[model samples]
Each structure stands twice: as C-alpha cells, then as structure tokens.
Target: MLALSAWAAASSRAWAQAPMEPHERDLYEAARREGQVTWYSAQYSADTSEAIGRAFTERYPGVRCSVVRSTSQVAFQRLSQDQRAGVAQCDVFASSNGGHYIQLKRQNRLTQFRPVNADGMLPMLRTADPDNYFQYSSLGIYLLGHNTNMVSDAEAPKSWADVLDPKWKDKLAVGHPGFSGAIGIWALQMRSMFGPDFLRRFERNKPQVGRSSIDPVTMMTAGERAVGVAVPSASTLFAASRGNPLKLIYPTEGVVAVPAPSAIMSNAPNPNAAKLFMEFNTGPALSRITRTMFSESLRPDVPPPEGCRPLDQVTLLSPSLEDADRGVPELREQWRDIFGV
Candidate 1:
C-alpha cells in the first residue's frame, strides 16, 4: 500500500510537471525589459486606438503602447515608408484590409507568430491569414444608420435600396472608398449585391461624402443627415450607448463584414513586445474594449456588448478573402467615377 501510494504521487507530479504554453510571467518579463510596443493601427478611430493603448499599458504596467492611428490606407502608406527608410518604428500593424496581410506575407514584411489565444477564436477568423503572418483582429461592419430624432423607426431605411428614396435626398451621408479601407470593401460588396447601377442611383440622394467610415455616424448624431450610407456599426453603437439619437440598420440585405487584420513587423524594434501585443490584440482584454466600439470580437467567449447583437446572430454580407482581394481595387475606380470623389 505504501509503494502504491508512492507511485500514484509520482505520476501526479510528472503529469503536473509536463511542459505547457509560455507563462504570462515570461512574456511580461521579456516585454517589460523591451519597454514599449509601437502600433500602427487603422482598425478604429484614433480615440479608440488611444483608449486601447492605455488599457494595454495599464494591464502590463511597465510596457508602453504607442498608437499611430489613421485610415487603413494612410497607415499602410506610412508603414511602407518606414520600411523603405529601413527604420523599424512600428512593432505591430493593424489594417482594415485583410488582403494587406496576403500582400505583406508575400513581400516577406510580416513576422510569423501564431498566438495560442488564436486557437480559441472563431474558425472563420482563424482562416483570415492562412500563413499566420497576420490574424483577424476585429470585424468592421458597414451598417445603415439614421437619426432617431429625424427618422421614425418605421421610416428608417431598412435596406441598401431604401437609401435611394427622394425623401432622403440631401439628407444622406457616405464615406469615400478612396480614403477608407472599410468603405472600399463596402463599395465592392454593394456593387456585387445591388448591381453596378446602384451607386449611380444612390448618388442622386446627394450623400454628403466624407473620408472616414465614421463620417455618416457623425452626421447622423448631429441630425445633419436623416440617413447614412456605409456608416460603421461601431460608431453607431458608441453614439447610441451615449444616448445619442443614432440608430443602426443592419440591412436585411446584410451588413458588410470588413475583417481587420493585425501583424507584427518582420523587423520589429521590439519583437518580444510585439508578440505580447499580438496576443493581447486577439485576447479577451482588447475584445472587451472593441466591443464597446461596436467591432465584433473573434473570440466565441467574448459576449457582445449590452444591446448589441452577436456576430453569429446578425446577418452579415461577408466577402471571402479572394473576392475582397480581387474586387476592392476594381470597385474603387468605379466608385470614383460614380461619386466623382
């Protein structure tokens, strides 16, 4: 009986001693010594990016998170310039364009590191970057929006086609596909769903075209526009949560799902910090922050914010990775011709 008890104790100790994933202490220790992580993120508004950076720093305590927020194209342009100059200022890159990862991976610009947390993410999100050079960090949805003070619930636009009514003419706002990556994807999806003549007709509404996805929500909040085209759901959620008169319409045709991707630079100045930041970006910590902004989390475990619908429950007009790569550029030129932007 004593020998049997000794064997049982030995087996339990061996099982407990088996090697496991890297501990948070190891990551934090290396990240602490590295000091900071610079993030060039075009995933959300500048303020949102800053808030997330603050949260990351607060969680890690010793490491700093420096955020350079801009539209996805602008962010990518700056990162490209940094690469050309051979200066590694950005530790992580977050862009709204999923195709950017494919381009970066092909160019050997991305450092591959698959986060263990990624295994817990939704299957579709995990496949966003097959090469593991980047990960699907968030979902940016293009939703129809209206001012509750100006448009009644019954009168609010329910579909992309509904925005074309003469009633909404001069009372609509839209983002320019040329300036915003999310808008570019939206333009492509709209073209595919509504046919080529759609935007031409939508143009007659005389939408107040702005350069950012948040423009429509801004217009709606101020009661300047009764309805908005291509308004980001995140902006609408934030506005509604603040008791603003903004409301989102996830068109019956489906809200456009723009998958944002994040990656570490191959020559990151602080690789350890970059890896840790990547884990945090996909982990529950940042997901909670993003949830408030209306961006859908990739993790199944991260519940949607109060009064917000889960991604699985919502009808999303999601384009495959290949379609986005092939269609976005083509749609951009078409958008310019129709919107004359």
Candidate 2:
C-alpha cells in the first residue's frame, strides 16, 4: 500500500513538473528537499577531488554530498561485496573503471537517467548509455612516470614497446591489471597486439606490480622502480609544475582512454540528492574539474588540458569491450601464470 502510494505521489508530481527541462528543474528542487547523497570515489588525492566536492556543496547549498574515497578496484570490490551482503550503503559510484562499470550495467543495478549535460561531451567520451551510468575521461587520464636519474630524456621508453627492453630487467614497475583499469587495458592491448608471448616478453623486464593501481607511480616517485607504467594526472601535473624532471610519455602508439564514470545506485535513499549531484558533476563543474586536473574534458570540443598533447596527434588504442570482456577471465589466468602472483 505504501509503495503504491509513494509511486502515485511521485508520478503526479513528475507530471505537474514536466517542463522542457524537467530533468534538471525538477531534480534540483526535489534534491534540495532530500538534502543528502553519498558517493564512493577512487581518487589519488583528496584535495583536488575534495575541492570538487566542496564546490558542489556550495553550488547546491541544501543538497549535501559526501564522498567515500577508495582505490578504483578496491572500491568496486567493496560495492560488489556490500551488494551481495545486502549492505548497500553507497548511493553512487564515480571511478575510472569502465570494464567493471560495463559489467554493472549488464546487471541492471543502475538507474538510467540521461544527464542534461550529455551534449557537452566529446565524441570519444560519450557512452552508449545516454543516461549517466558511465562516461569516459580524456586521453591518458593516467601517465607514464620514470625515475629522473635512471631513464634519460632521449633514452626513455617513448612507446609501450620500449618498456619491453631487457635493459630495465626487473627494474620496471607495472600496475596490477585487476586494480588498474589503465593497466588492464594496457595488458589487453599488449595481448591484442603481441599474442601469448607478450607477458613472457614483459617478464624479461621483470616488472614489479603495485598493490594498488597507483603503486607504479609510488614506486617511480621513490626511485624504487626506474620506469613505471601509470600515474594519476594530478600527480603528474603537480610533479611537472615543480619541474620534477618526470616526463609524461604521450604514447607514440596513441594514448588509451577509458570511462571514469559516475552512476546513481538503484536503491539510493536519497535519489533526489543523487540525481542533483550527478547533474551538478556532469555539467560545467566537470569541465572545470577535469581541465584543472589536466584531464581532457569529456566535452569533446573543449581543448586539451594545458601541457598536454592533442589526442588526434598521438596513436590510440581502440579497445573492444566485447573482446575485453571475453578476454578478462583468460587474461587474469595468463597474468597469474606468467607473473606467478
């Protein structure tokens, strides 16, 4: 009886609220009344991300947004575990793991609401889900990092192949494929290009895998690993700003990009707040946040971030999700067998 009554009330309001921009105007007013939303995010730093959060709360004064940060892989694991245990504490998820989000979309655990700001995205960043279940970030959202004293300017691995060189034997730091979607695609791309020998060839370099996805950067930053696979754009830019001698290797084979999407949970306690938050994040604020973080904005026509090369100029890897999904189980087996993890 209660559920039916609630549905009737919501439908009646939705009807009365139907304007050309009903998605936003209705969401905004409804959100102010609900007042709170929870987000599970995986970000390398709290400051910049939190700045986004703080700015959001300020922007939507009555709508409170709380973010729980975690590593992307770990965050996904938590979400999965929580869901199975019937402890759905998270209201939304914002992360750079497209493959995982794709799996979630398959399960229909997500709400489908097209963002009012979808028109702002670049052609490449757009998702099939016109609703905001997922959205891709700009090119090389993660970057290559190397120890200054070890890899020289001209000697560094300009392309992904350079990392396979035996010179860096056991000296290279690679991200754990499961934890790092950036590396997961890199791994898939490696196999996609090189066949079964790729991991064995990579092994000759004796790449050390990080615990979390960002471990490679941590290793490179400490000079523990001479050459590393990926670093958050924030860390790369901050290091570059200080003239850290670290280089951003815009892949000669083209930078790979994946969706760092935000999704609203189906059973969200604060659906109104969640909707408002998503709209706020996906709009002008996302453009500003991404631009500030040195990421290519999803808004396609927007220019590349400062100190970044244009995506068109570099070689890119177009991953087939269908292929990626098929390969994941086998890929994980291959990684374990080869890496002996």
Candidate 3:
C-alpha cells in the first residue's frame, strides 16, 4: 500500500509539472493548420523582432510568424486603425506601454488565454490583467548611454543632472514621449523626480529627438550624438557587442525599467497560433535570445547579460500603472511645448 501511494504521489507531481494539457495539444494542431501568426510589436527593433519571429517559426514547423515592428505609439495606432476599420490583421500585440492593454481590455479588444508557461515565470513578469488578457514579455532599462570613443570614462555623466549640462548641447540624443513608450515612462519618472521646470531647462540644450528608444544608439554609433538620456541598456549592450562603442550608464538617481506586455487580439484571425506564440515567449526556449539582446529575462532562473547588473541589483524608478496612464498624456503635451517636436 505504501509503495502504491508513493508512486501515485510521484505521478501527481509529474502531472503538475507538465507544460501543457490535451486541450493545448488541440490548440497546437489547430495552429499548425492555420500556418501563420501576425504579430504587431514595439518591444524591440525590426531586427530583434524578426529574430523572435524566425525563432517562433523554427519552433513550430509550418507556422510562420509575421512581425510588424514600430514604435509603441505607432504600433498601437496601427492596431487601433485596423480594429476601427473592422479588419483586424494583428493576431498578437506587444507594446512597452502596459496602459494600451488596459484600455484594450476595457473595450473588449483583447482575448483571454493564459499561457501555460506563466506558471514558471517570475512574479514580477506576471502583471497581466486579472482575466489574463496580456502578459509582460520583455524588459529594458531606460537611462543614460554614451559613445565610449567620444566620451572618455572621466567625461561620462553619472546622474540625471549631469545630462542637463550645457556641454552636451546639440550633442545629446533622446526619444520623444509622443512616440516611444519607453520615453513616455521615462518622462513620467523624470517629472515625478524633478519639477516641470526641469524639462524646459533641459530643452535649452537642444537635444536631438527621435521616435524610437533604439535611435539614440544609432545616433551615437553614427557620431551624431555623444550622449543619450533615453537609450535602453539592452540596445547599448547589443551595440557594444557588435563593436559600436556604446555604453550604458545607470544613473545615480535610478534606472527606469520598461516592461513590454504582449496580448492576443479579440478579433484575431488565427487564435490558436497567437496562443502558441504567447507560449513560446513565456516558455524556456526564448530566454537565451532575450539574454543575447541583454534584456532582463522574465524567468528568474535566467541571469542577465554579462556586464549588465541584474534588475534587483539596479536602482530602478518605475511608475504605477495609474500614474503612467494618467501622466503620459500631460507629459507628452508638455514635452512638445518645451521641445517643439
């Protein structure tokens, strides 16, 4: 009797540890038949996005993952436009701004399907809607970055106040809050950390503004800018790995962490494929890719990239969902007023 009970307990534990059920097998088969999943994402650049898509295709044979990559605001606008026209082309949507999913869920635009891999994800990465409408798939740190060749270690700025120095006028790069979700959150953090007058004063430096967070590294790589206040550390690390002379500076104040969330569209043409894509993201296979990009992994077991400190070790500044949703609009308007973008 004891031997039988022990065997039964072990079987139960194995069942609990399984990644999927019979119903999920049905979903996988259906996804195979569908053959394609359309992904609209602003989580990364086109290259990284395409890499993720290709990885998904390689994982699930016969199923292609088509990615439409852009800035978060532009991607959201495109998704919204498609929805309004009654032609939903996006099967999955990922944005750095979590507020988008909240608004979509409220409007019944997001489908509810919990990925089986969610069970293994870190608690910090599981901040989806109560109904499981979305899941955070990627993370980036928003802070200062510089061209190592242009700015020596002694000349590197260490804090938020240092970037405002007149020495960087016309030599600084930043992202526009109206376009990049990373910038929107960083703007919110800045406004909360500093006063409204801070932006007006910083604008006097005449910083070059771009639509994507990744643009700063591009500007730095091209020798167009010496410093960037809005570059993602992951992008910097990736560029540095390619011998681009880029380096990230974790501001003495704090680094702003951007968590990009992915969700299924309510009117998805290929629901099964969308679910499979979500599973692939939260599953074990994608951690290596994310690490290669120097992004903070959703799985705690996966350590951050070398030379990049772990999330917990970094001093971080994050706005609440309510603060972000409420403050982004005001900050964008103020930013335009100051920078004249």
Best by TM-score: 3
Q: What is the C-alpha RMSD of each candidate to the true structure, in Å?
A: 9.5, 9.3, 8.1
- C-alpha lDDT of candidate 3 relative to the true structure: 0.81
Top lDDT prediction, candidate number: 3
* lDDT of the candidates, in the order given: 0.79, 0.66, 0.81
lDDT of 1 by residue, 198-219 (tens): 8898889898998888888888
List the candidates ranked by TM-score, beginning with the highest: 3, 1, 2
Ranking by lDDT: 3, 1, 2
Candidate 3 lDDT, 1-341, residue by residue in tens: 24433543454344334565665567779999999999997987776677678777765668899989889999989988997798979999998887787788889988988888877887877756677888878877888989988998789999998877888888899998889988999988887888778888789889999889888888999999999887988788878877788888888988998877899999999999999989878865566555666666778766666668877778878887667777887888999888889
Q: Which ten residues in a row have the lowest lDDT in candidate 3?
A: 7-16
Q: How many residue pairs clash in each candidate?
A: 0, 8, 0
Error (Å) of candidate 2 at residue 208 is: 2.2
Worst 10-residue lDDT window for candidate 1 reads 11-20
C-alpha TM-scores of all predictions: 0.89, 0.85, 0.91
TM-score comparison, 1 vs 3, better candidate: 3
Where is model 1 more than 4 Å wrong at Cα? 1-21
